[model samples]
Target: MNCEQIRELLAGYQDGELDGAQHEMVSGHLEECADCRAELAQLDKVKEVTGKVKYNDLPLEVWEGYWQGIYRRIERGLGWIFASVGAVIMLITGAYYLVKDYFMDPAVALFPKIGVGALIIGGGFLLVSVGRERIFAHNRDRYKEVQR
Candidate 1:
């Protein structure tokens, strides 16, 4: 076989993947060609160096930081979720009582009831608008990572 063909199979031959005929052909070429022999030697050195490559590990602080970030995100997310749920439940109950007891009373004057209803509606809209704005700003806050 030519040097190029034999060199192509050199890795396979080194790993004992070549059949007897192929092995003998490569051996014959390596014996006669100094260039092929040099190539085989270089391949052997590369295989040795790569086989000895070791795995490196990150430092303790890196792992600690990773875990801390994860825990903080989970803790804050759950806290906010639980607090919002509780507040919503209380708001619903209070709203129900206000509507049933105050708004439904026949003795209540029309003007006062209309004023209170308008105040509650405006407050609800303001609360929703502020909450949405806060969430939008929080998501896009470019300087949130800046330390004081």
Candidate 2:
């Protein structure tokens, strides 16, 4: 057998899975080929190290608690989302009324009105800047789909 064929059969040979004829063919090739022998030796080392490794399995109670923790996080996240939306709506409504009242009052100075307008414009610019930054960051983020 050629080097490629012998290499392919090396795994099965190491595991003693080959029949009499195939076994003899791979054995003869290994005797003559130093490179294939080296490769087989490397494969044997890998198998030996991996065979000694052990994995720990979690108990059922730990798994149940893990799922419960996830559920609680989801529930809290939804609650916070609702609370934030409500708070933002209330704040916007209050700001609108305050601005409207200021504009309607005869005693209010022109400079204060102008200042409020400038503040609103500045807030708009800040919001847009933050949005653009978030979009750019999202595009560049390598682990965008990876969960927390």
Candidate 3:
């Protein structure tokens, strides 16, 4: 067999997978061809090197670092949730008192109540707009995951 044909059969020959005739043919070609012998030698070296490789777990510090990052994210998320809840409760209570003590009182002028209502509505819209813009920008930011 030629070098190409023998090269193709070299792996099967190495593994003893070829039938007797093909094995002998490749063996004869390998014996005569220096290039084929070198090719087979390289293949053997690669197989040996890869076969000796073993998997090992990462160090304890590595695992700890990963868990710490996860825990920090969870803590910050919970803190934000609690802070937002507290702010909402405070806003609702303040609005209730303002309406009960001033808006519902007959002594308060009409213009002042209208001004306060407009201020509250305007502030709420601005807050919602800023929040939506932040969320939109966050969603569109391409470099969010890139650390400096």
Q: What TM-score goes with each of the models?
A: 0.55, 0.42, 0.53
Q: Which model scores highest in TM-score? A: 1
How many residue pairs in model 3 have overlapping backbones?
0
Off by over 4 Å in 1: 1-58, 142-148
- Which digits, one per residue and each the tens of the lDDT, describe model 2 over residues 8-123? 99999999999999999988988888999999999999888776552223466667878887887688679868987997898699778977798778799999988988988898
* Prediction-by-prediction clash tally: 0, 0, 0
Mark the 10 consecutive residues where model 3 has the least summed lDDT.
51-60
Q: Which sequence of candidate numbers ranks them by lDDT, best first?
A: 1, 3, 2
In model 1, the Cα lDDT at residue 81 comes to 94
Give the root-mean-square deviation of each candidate in angstroms: 14.7, 12.3, 14.1
Cα-based lDDT for every prediction: 0.86, 0.83, 0.85
Name the Cα RMSD for model 3.
14.1
User: Which prediction has more favorable TM-score, 1 or 2?
Assistant: 1
Candidate order by TM-score, highest to lowest?
1, 3, 2
Least accurate 10 contiguous residues by lDDT in model 1: 52-61
